[model samples]
Target: MSGIELKQLSEKVFYLPGTVNAAIVLNEEREAILLDTGSDKDHGRRLKKACDNLGVKPVVIVNTHSHADHYGGNDYLTRNFDLPVYAPPLEAGIIQNPVLEPIYLFSGAKPLPELMSKWLLAKPSRVDHILEPGALELFGVALEIIDSSGHAHRHYSVKIADVLVAADAVFGINILQKYPLPFGQDIGGQIASAERMADVGAQVILPGHGEASEDIAGLVKANIAVFEKAAKTIVGACTGVAATTVLKRSCEILGITIKDLPRYYLNHCTVMAYLSYLRESGHVELALQDNELRWSAAGN
Candidate 1:
């Protein structure tokens, strides 16, 4: 919270920097619509303080996705204010049941304590609205919901006032450099979404974890490049190897070390996504080899 400040990006759009970026869009009535809260209650409290400092009332919260870092503060915000929480379909389910995140990551089994940390599990909050892709008007501000599902299932980006609140459709360059795989449920959809983002008629793009940029095309291109590189690496490693082996080999190639349970599961899920994308694209095929699931280049 030391260097965090509410910076205005447009006429009425402002953002607060934290472990994740949260945005505030002011409407005609001086009320604000929050675009994703920060990671937890403390972060929510800071956001509230920032809003109060700016003398705007946060009347609603539109969550871009169900990832803990994006919607973790929903409970806090709803508890203090009678706020309406909005989320996309599948993501709404997870946001209302925070445990589902770790459960899904653990393949529907009981997750270990290490995987149930606050970073992975947030307090569940009620979703008052289920958002759909298309035009939406909240608090007198018109917004177009662009389907950006890939990073998370049912993730949507909001375009208001020529600024796109691109939740996780595109990661910041620093984040992409750090985590080459960048946690996605559908690699193909993620790549397509990144391409779609390039065509978004927006002057500014605010990403979930990094600073907003006016160079939307540049960011989108970088994101696409990262996705392509990861897909190529995963496909190359899939030469008659077990899925786990492919993940391990990809990690080695990317210089990623699984230091913790969360990291391991995140990377594992991302690798599975890559496999799905490759299989769909007919570049790889799966087989049962001696009771172990194996993946190899197609037409083998």
Candidate 2:
């Protein structure tokens, strides 16, 4: 709480950041609608404490996406508040069985124990409501569920008044900031998602990983250029390139120097998944030529 800043966008919407951003919406009757819980088990406790400190009980929980950091506190919230949870309909299937997808082991700094990791996975659960883009009512405030799926393919950004919970669709490791995260399932879609949120024209853009920004539209525009260029580069160079070669080329193309993280971490491992997914999805093709593996994107 030392560096954390909790900003009230209005009586209905509050922006609180600690490790991640969470939103609190107040109903006319003073109940709360919570969005995107933090990254650990204690998040709900902290949330409840914050509520007690502020004097309101949260009665609803909305997960903008299914990532561990966003939904990790689901177990806690449901147990404590009997809140009805909601998610994008497309993702409810995965939510029903939230496995800590094998992909994260390669990206996270400290992986969960096998037993805990298995349990951390999403359980097949019921969503009280499934959302679609545009203005919708929740608690007392009017909310918007805008599709911003590039980060997770099923991610959504929650908007209340002038503030938008950009979710992972537009925040976290901005690859443009560094060696961009290998975590996305689709680079192209991720960039598109960023643009969609920006276009929503919010005054305060609350992202998933970093500080809130006012010029989110500009940020999205800039990163889209980066994404498009990277996609073109990957498509252009692929007959199949070595993993090291790809990483090196990626570093150069993204205008960032890449320091490799551990393979078990989700960051590095997701690179492998991205490539495999690209190949499997027919966005790219794979082959072994001259005893060196290479990749080629499908013709534009």
Give me candidate 1's TM-score against the actual structure: 0.97
User: Could you estimate the TM-score for every candidate?
Assistant: 0.97, 0.77
Worst 10 contiguous positions by lDDT, candidate 1 = 1-10
For model 1, residues 1-300, the per-residue Cα lDDT tens digits are 232488778888889976689999998887889999989998888888888888888999999999998988889999989799999999999999999999999889999999999999999999999999999999899989999999997899999969888989999888888888899999888989988987979999988877788999999999999999899899889889898899999999988888999989989989998899899999999998799998998887
Clashing pairs in 1: none
Most TM-score-accurate candidate: 1
Which candidate number maximizes lDDT?
1
lDDT digits (tens) for residues 8-62 of candidate 2: 7655677567767887777878688888777656776777767665677888888
Error of 2 at 83 (Å): 0.5
Instruction: Note each model's CA RMSD in angstroms.
Output: 1.7, 4.9
For the record, the alpha-carbon RMSD of candidate 1 to the native fold, in angstroms, is 1.7
What is the lDDT for 56 in model 2?
78
lDDT of each: 0.90, 0.66
Q: Model 1 residue 263 lDDT? A: 88
